[model samples]
Target: MRGFGDLEAEIMDRLWSWGRAATAREIVDDLQLRRPLAYTTVTTVADILHTKGWLRREKVGRAWVYEPTCTREAYTAQLMHQALETTSDRAGALLHFVDRMSGDEASALRAALEQVKERDTP
Candidate 1:
């Protein structure tokens, strides 16, 4: 998962929601919650994502359609790994992660641990 600025996250969300491909104009219209974005801004972000390997683009007539190359789960795992990499103290980071997690995240941690244990069983 790549680390995204808030706008990038919203852009990725729009692409992921489609699960196919969308033009920059489509993305700008979709993310109207923050503020309406210029098509050029959307195009720039899509270009960045493509260059960073986070997005794939296909030619569609005069425009390129962009889609997320990574799934939401994969993106999240990558982001988590990146965060962990930046922490100087692994233990402290883990504790902070646990402490700051919402209930759902805590539960997801429990589920992941159980799955890991299950995989370790003979």
Candidate 2:
């Protein structure tokens, strides 16, 4: 969240969702909001992702196929860790975050945790 741009987020989502390597054109095709972007733009973004250590690339034929280096959950956890590193008041920031979530969101989180616990225990 913190280290990503709009395009980066979109591209990462596409790569992670596919769970496979993809070229820039392949990434562009998955975008729902169709916009005229040159192939260079996508390549540049993919390169930037690689530079940021969020993506890994492999040359395939004439194109470089890119894939996410980390899972979505791992990336999110890293972002949270970065946030904590930046904040002096970690407890206060966490309290504020919990305060902002709606009751339904809290319940959903609890349910997800319970499911994970059940799976882990049994």
Please write out the lDDT profile of model 1 over residues 1-122, one tens digit for every residue. 44788878888988787787898878888877668678888889889989989899999899898888989898888878888998799899999889999999899999999999999999
lDDT score for candidate 1 against the true structure: 0.86
lDDT of 2 by residue, 2-120 (tens): 67888888899889888999988888776735776677877898999999889999998988999899999899878878888788999999888779999997898789889999999
The collision pairs in model 1 are 1-78
Cα-lDDT of candidate 2: 0.86
Worst lDDT run of 10 residues, candidate 2, spans 29-38
The C-alpha stretches of model 2 lying farther than 4 A from their native spots are 104-122
Clashes of each: 1, 0
Top of the candidates by TM-score = 1
- TM-score for predicted model 2 compared with the true structure: 0.75
lDDT per prediction? 0.86, 0.86
